[model samples]
Target: MTSLKNVQSKSSKSCYVIFCCCTFIFAPLLIGSIIYQSSGIKIPTILSSINATFSVENLIDSPTKIIATIPHIPLESFICDKINISRFPVSSTTQTNDSFDVYRKNVLEKYCDIVPVPRYNWSSPKSYTENDIAFVIFTAAAFFHTRTTAARDTWVSRITNYYFLSATPYPYLPITVVPGAGEDKLSNMKKLFYGLQIIYKQQMNLSPDKQQKWFYIAGCDTFILPHHLLKRLHGLDYRQPIRVGGHWGQHDCPGPNGTKFQAEFPSGGAGFFFSMKLLEILQPHLTNYVENVWPRNSEISDVALSCLSHQLGVPLTKQVGFWAHPPAFTLGENGRDKFHKEPEPNDFHYIKPDEMHALDEFYIYQHMDRLINDRNWSEFTQFMRRFVASHYELLRKKRRECTLPTIEAEVKLSNK
Candidate 1:
């Protein structure tokens, strides 16, 4: 009986230990769950903040950092939201007059209606006149974090205020907020092509001379625009049907480090306008090539598009200064290291810290109440002035200022 009693006692102790172990293991988890629910915390948002903060440290922290460095954009933001492009006009062949006019007309005539005057409310308010061209920008949210409600409010406020206060309206330029699915990141991009096809078929079913216009897939963050490229397009055979793509920055090439460290492709963040004829051809074939190697995942979207175009047997037009190759905004050599090299007059430049904070401030202004709050409001307002003013000289002058090529080459290599 004594031995039986000892065995019972041992069993009871084991049960108690098991209960304690479970409690110890689950206590924090239970608490975290309650807090997460109560606080309305999104795991992705938290994770994005955590992920974006790591930077260079992550690349070196071996496999641990690599495993933790998954992209953390919110799930709500990832689900591809439908955006209607029906209102975007695709009329080609209105004029064959001026050389510059004919060049732009031929290149852009197929997928866009090139009018001398701005018909849409989406034109830049400051520059919107009777003769400004109306081109639609797509899925621009990735380029403009300030426009994203989840990013910096200051950035949102600045862009809005600049456009609105400046009296601008970006009407038909609907930003696609969702990330699409495919074997590659760009598999979802095919949906854009297919969606355009559906919209085009629905609209242009009637007219034999239905003017298909140019489709500008603009990268918002890039700040370069190559004028020589515009000049070159004038020389292409408009009847042959041509499409343009690339970084389309303001400068000549990627600064030093950008060329080396960054991916080289026909398209990138600044924006590249494609020919409507190309889209019409690719629209039908997009589904078959969704998993093809060209649209596969990579650091550069334009590069992927270029690759996909090649795989689909589409030819991409090559031109000098087409994409501002190195991109003056993010990865360029000129404006990146401001302390070391002075920016030329025309570069749309931002300081490193300023660029980082700009998106956050934009988010605060767009989605939160920091604008009215004194602490954030003052800082944000000053930031706007400085940010806008930094490029004020260039905007007013509108000159194509080129830096010394030797200097450009040197800055191209420096990552900073």
Candidate 2:
């Protein structure tokens, strides 16, 4: 009996030790998980802490580590990609007198006169050297075959990692048709929030190298100078929270103090650029806190986005590049709103299809004229973005008195 008692005592002590070790090892993780789950705000990762604490130098090897080699679910396995909460609260001001069917019908009917873009070869690429950038092309299905087509043909065609979130799916376009994203035409707040959410989920991981660090979000009508934009992002760390756009000092966005005076953000049409870390911090709040407190009153998508970033502690950082309006020779001031009174536009917003094609030429030939004629690549402006520019413009000068987006051109182009 004494011998049995001794053995049982030893067993009890061994069990106690094992239990303590487990608590020490997993207690923090459990606590952190609980906090994240409950608040849906701060997510604690163990990749080094959540991803394995890798060095910046180490990211060079796998710069796209966000998409795990083995995803939680297979990419092709997706039949539907709805968020946790599919619709806004019925009491919210986003509710409309017109049902979604009516809204979508109006959208389609409005753009029905436009021709559908030819299907792109999804398997191959447009041959430009891929960069660590992911594009969020916020589009409506109405513009899918027109404006988006123009963009895809020019610069977007060259980049393979672009995303299109449409109100309804275009069977031919490689896009995700989100449910509530477009139902409320009151504002583009839902669309913008879901867009970033989708992007964040697509590359959620601890591996910094496996994720595209820089994200650019713009409307389908916006024209992008990817090569020029890349220069802007050079040497910027992906881990830092960076937001760059037209620093329109507007205080109409939502604030942490339940007001719109907290944040000043960039123009949505011209587009905005952000780093990965800022996105990660904002990911959790998109579905929960954001939707709940979004403006029922006067809310602009760009303002709301900027305000949210400010609330999350990120401020707008701008440099010389954005063209808030479409390109006009006399539009920008040298050291003021743009680089040099020149239309050295990094992103041109509120443009039409013809202007997109024309602007493509305007930028392309200016470089070709320089390279073949002057042969000077200095100040980094010479190449035609040669490989990226359209072959149709190679022999022609489409920039001279061509169709522009100055209100009238869009009307004329639409009639044709």
Measured by C-alpha RMSD in angstroms, how accurate is candidate 2? Answer: 26.8
* lDDT digits (tens) for residues 45-149 of candidate 1: 323323212212221222211112233223221111111221234446553343333333333232111111111111111312111111322333233324222
Best by the TM-score measure: 2
Can you tell me which runs of candidate 2 are displaced by over 4 Å?
1-130, 205-208, 256-260, 297-299, 329-343, 371-416
- Which regions of candidate 1 deviate over 4 angstroms? 1-145, 148-192, 202-212, 223-232, 237-239, 246-264, 292-300, 311-314, 322-416
The stretch of ten residues in a row with the least summed lDDT in candidate 1 is 114-123
The positional error of residue 225 in candidate 1, measured at the CA in angstroms, is 6.0
Per-model TM values vs. the true structure: 0.33, 0.56
- Lowest summed lDDT window (length 10), candidate 2: 70-79
> For each candidate, what is the lDDT?
0.36, 0.59
